[model samples]
Target: MPSPVSDIPAATPDLAAAHYAGKLAFETDCSDVRAAFAAGKVDFVLLDVRSPALFQQAHLPGAINLPHGKMTAHRMAEWAKDTLFVVYCAGPHCNGADKAAFRLAKLGLQAKLMIGGMTGWADEGFAFESQAAAAE
Candidate 1:
């Protein structure tokens, strides 16, 4: 008897490859973000699509706080049309990142979701920055 995991036939290797490759175009993980920052190769903008208050509390070092609700074409125009944006929210439990990505797409910009969000960063034991420190 096929186990529950295998009950549904898996896609062929080629199809699986395509599926994952497609996913990579839309999402990135915390480790890659950190690596980019460490190597000074951060070519994309990292956006924290959470409330300003939440953002001030703690956020990724290089991330900018831009709540999904405040995403407007006028505001996004500050960046080049082809600029790539990487967005994240509180965690897997939040959809703010998805909303921000959708808004960016609507404005004809490219965006990818940073999987795991702040929760993922914390899970990776990455250091965080707060607005308080920036002010000091």
Candidate 2:
């Protein structure tokens, strides 16, 4: 196998960190996320970290609700081991996704924050499903 350092191709430690940060950021975005979902990829689960009320207002399709505050190792007992969770909240103004990811990490679960979140998805002209709409 190639040397791990040479494989990444970073000129400096700072640059390496920055590059990895950007690459990590892409783990969750509207277009890429949507494509992954439509293609039925099994590696990740979309997690809505917002409260049920907010999730009811609108949320990404197929996302499961798990409020950051209520998240704990025990609360995640039902989740399969090693399954990646893509966490998101209302919008950029909301830090719920980050908090949720942190909490999940504390419990040894893998989680990625969906950048731009609900607002970002809606801003891209994609539609969201609200409880009201679902009921109608």
Candidate 3:
């Protein structure tokens, strides 16, 4: 017969904290996120946290340009609480998305990182919107 103590399962909360500290809580792979966008299930904000020049060059369709350095709670308030905000930067080496996600989280908003950033988004061959299209 199993001992009474053996029946108890180990709680992962403590271990998980150590493993997840200094890392993003929600990390969605590029393909999954792309599929969600294609299926129209992703109605959340796709925030581009890169520089203005990079943003103007090209960005995911429907993405809002909010450079990481300039992000403020007031500016982010435009989005609804229920909205699922997805943040991205230039590439894997970039930390802008992480910063943006943290800021959003501090404001009591839910934010997730697009794991590979815009470079991965571009590699997926997803269409991007530009200022020209917005004006048209």
Best candidate (score: TM-score):
1
Error of 1 at 65 (Å): 0.9
Candidate 2 local lDDT, 1-136, one digit each (tens): 6698788665789888999898785457887788887898747888899889988998888878889999877878888978788989888999998899899888888888888899889888887888888899
> Considering lDDT, where higher is better, how would the candidates rank from best to worst?
1, 2, 3
The C-alpha lDDT values of all candidates are 0.96, 0.84, 0.80
lDDT of 1: 0.96
Clashing pairs in 3: none
Arrange candidates, best TM-score first: 1, 2, 3
lDDT of 1 by residue, 1-136 (tens): 9999999999999999999999999999999999999999999999999999999999999999999888998999899998999999999999999999999999899999999999999999999999999899
Over 4 Å off, model 3? 1-25, 133-136
TM-score of each prediction:
0.96, 0.80, 0.73
Deviation from native of the Cα of residue 121 in model 2, angstroms:
0.4
Please provide, for model 3 over 8-109, each residue's C-alpha lDDT reduced to its tens digit, 9 standing for 90 to 100. Answer: 765599877766764555776578777887798876788899988888878877678898777787887787777778899987989999999888888888
* lDDT winner, 1 or 3: 1
